[model samples]
Target: KTTDILVQAQICAALNRHVIDVTTPNVGLQDWSNSAEYYQQSPCNHYAKFWDQQGISVDQLAYGFPYDDVFEYSSSVHTPSPSRVVVSFGPYTDGGGNDNDEDITGMGGNLSVQFTDSPAGEGFANLIDNDAATKYLTFNSSAWVQFQANNAYSLSSYSITSANDAPQRDPLNWNLQGSNDGVNWTALDVRSGVDFPSRQQKQTFQVAANSAFTYFRFNLTNNSGSILQLAEIELFGEGSSSGFSQTIQAENYSSMSGVQLENGAGAEADQNVGYIDTNDWMAFNSINIPNSGNYTVSYRVASEGSGGELSLDVNGGANVLGYRTVPGTGGWYNWTTVSHTIYIEAGTYNFGIFAQTGGWNLDSWTISLASGASAQSAATAFNSENSMLEIAEISLSPNPAKSQLQIDFTAEHANLTLLNAHGRLMESTSNVPSGSLLSISHLKKGLYFLQVEIDGKVTVKHFIKE
Candidate 1:
């Protein structure tokens, strides 16, 4: 019986599991397994048994099976950037393989995955295992998978890979939502009529979101068939933008006009404000614009008609921020993001989104500090040196310092913060003195931004670490 089982394993490996008609080669590697009498490792570690080869070194032999590297027992090089690589197909010297390297996917940070529904064998964990050969499938079409991380990630994009079989089971529509409490969710991106044309094919879409969330939920609402299968899901990009960034759901308004809420598709709120017409508007109170100059307001909107336009204003059009033309997205739920960067003053006001042309559905809106507009330059912030409420005159010698950076300010005490280009805080010091020297030797060679907060005012400036 053992001999017959070995032959069956060998046949399964030789066929590659997909060939309909094939000719078996005369000579091939043999597959073997041992019973408890001979093997001591658990069943989970049995894959490592084949490589043992009765103490015969596999370091100089080809892999006997596809998964021979189950326990880092095969020839694989993992590096962020290899100085040089030399590969020889015939004979090569073993450089002593290093298997302790961390997985490349872990750079995005570790995530604990959970799902609302899936089969026993086909688990949600497979969706992020980085193995395209495995997949997550479910009979329930309306399934949602949530990924929680230790820190919030300002995800810029995410990808989905179709399973190896059953193209009809691919998801047709979904939403990528984010939350801090895992209960009060915010729709980050929404997609409808999604199609996976090829098997095991990956499709990446940009996340129209600015705020960061520790919890992300991939809510699959619709599919072609009654089932859904996905081989993998990969999230890309991290860190939120510097300065103020706020996203408000359109349905969560203080007041509205000429619109009604209805169930929508994708990673947005369950309800969207639709039936908009010219002169219709929604207002949000206490919308704070912190040190704002030129703020970019992005609207998540969709329309099936030809023309749709909206205007952002403060206090019932007392001050119009700007207008954006919403493009027809083929369906009312086929959401897309549109933006308008307009100058805004630093104050808390009742913000309003008024329909200028109408015929569109509003899912959500985000207002973020525009790049290079986080705050007035350090020089401008210090123009009034006598004002006690403003940051003092600041200066940094050696604009592109190699190891040390000197910060000079006139304030008796001020808070200094260092952030990478992605707005990730690297170091911070409170009540820093004038002419304070900071060590930057540990930071990589790149651009960095420094924020100086004095009294209640904040000033931003950029510097280079070389």
Candidate 2:
């Protein structure tokens, strides 16, 4: 079986043909096992051995992914930015304990204060100082610690660490508040009857909010005793303008038909979704799109079976936002990444990855909007070379062109071909004159690469189809 496989591969290489059905296991690199295995490693690590023997570069290789699998499925994004915080502490006032000044740098050199005196070593600043030996004790029920973020943000989660000392002094209940200004506050998160059994242990609480907030207040209501104390507080979130990536785990599909969640597969993000066949589909919904801009969506895919392709569409639309081809890696556990950049307006859209073809396993995928990459910059990669590709030399009028687009070239004639954002050919015309009109009304309303091939040299220009 191995000799025949090598022979076939050699013949295909000589004829400039590639095989999508053959992989490393077919040649016996790693023993094939039907049992559970890691699925997160790049699948093509063993391809170098074959290329080395044949003395051929891997870049020249191409693939024809089987798109026979078609299944039904269902999917948000938020960005971030830098943040500024103004600190303030105190009202009732009390610092007399063992030594509170030792924790001045605890809150990034921010101010700290408390109400009433600590018995001896306990101080308010010690509450967040991460020391069981040190504690912040407050007798008043109304004492609170607050932070005001200069650049407003929304938190997805928060955590608090308990002091290692007395459990009776640990904070039991608190209300998280957000405010534009300090005075008027809205409840963002609230905790009641929460307890910590072990000292110095941290517990996390999940909360949801989309509104930008400048001020956050943690109101300590009640504790195990009449006094309250805490070790640390942590807020996990981002500023409104910070661009971020959202990863969708393949196994977390809302509803998947003809697929299985392969567990203990060495996936860093839990199990992967595999067992794909024709008509298999997965679905994700309510993905957050925090801003409007060009975003790159990347997929981690693997397969030992025939290579395949997938299409990304929004809201169950027939129009594909992006399409990618998956080439075979050596084994089912081998993995590879495919990505596409496209422009999408700011809004929550149901993102779906449909198997135009099956035979591939997906680990996870992510979407990220790059900073400074706007709509115009998102118009695919295009260059006309010479002065022809220059803005003043060549004129493409009515940008975001609705109907017919006119291209006036300094030269007499140039070859023109239209390509999608992925650089795949959509339309081609050879030897079009200097001044010509092209009908792009039928094209999808997104970025397209227009290549002007002249004298066997290519110059490309990007334009939007309205």
| Best model number under TM-score | 2
lDDT of each: 0.64, 0.58
lDDT of 2 by residue, 220-274 (tens): 8656457777766655554455666898888777766778888635545468888
Candidate 1's error at 160, in angstroms? 0.4
Candidate 1, which segments miss by more than 4 Å at Cα? Answer: 1-117, 240-466
RMSD per candidate (Å) reads: 22.3, 29.5
Q: lDDT by residue for model 1 over 1-466, one digit each (tens)?
A: 9888656654543343222122455344322321112223223223333333221222322355564443334446579987998754421112121221111122223344444366776777677654455689887767787765433457767778888788888888898888866689998988999888877777878766467665778878546668877888766644334557899999999998888899987676488899999999999999877542456689989998875878888978887766677889998998999975566556789999999888999999999865443233323333323343445788886876768999888888676656554443444455578888888765544456787777647777667654
Instruction: Give RMSD (Å) of candidate 2 vs. truth.
Output: 29.5
Give the TM-score comparing model 1 with the true structure, all chains together. Answer: 0.33
Range of the 10 consecutive residues with the lowest summed lDDT in candidate 2: 68-77
TM-score of each: 0.33, 0.35
Candidate 1 RMSD computed on C-alpha atoms after optimal superposition onto the true structure = 22.3
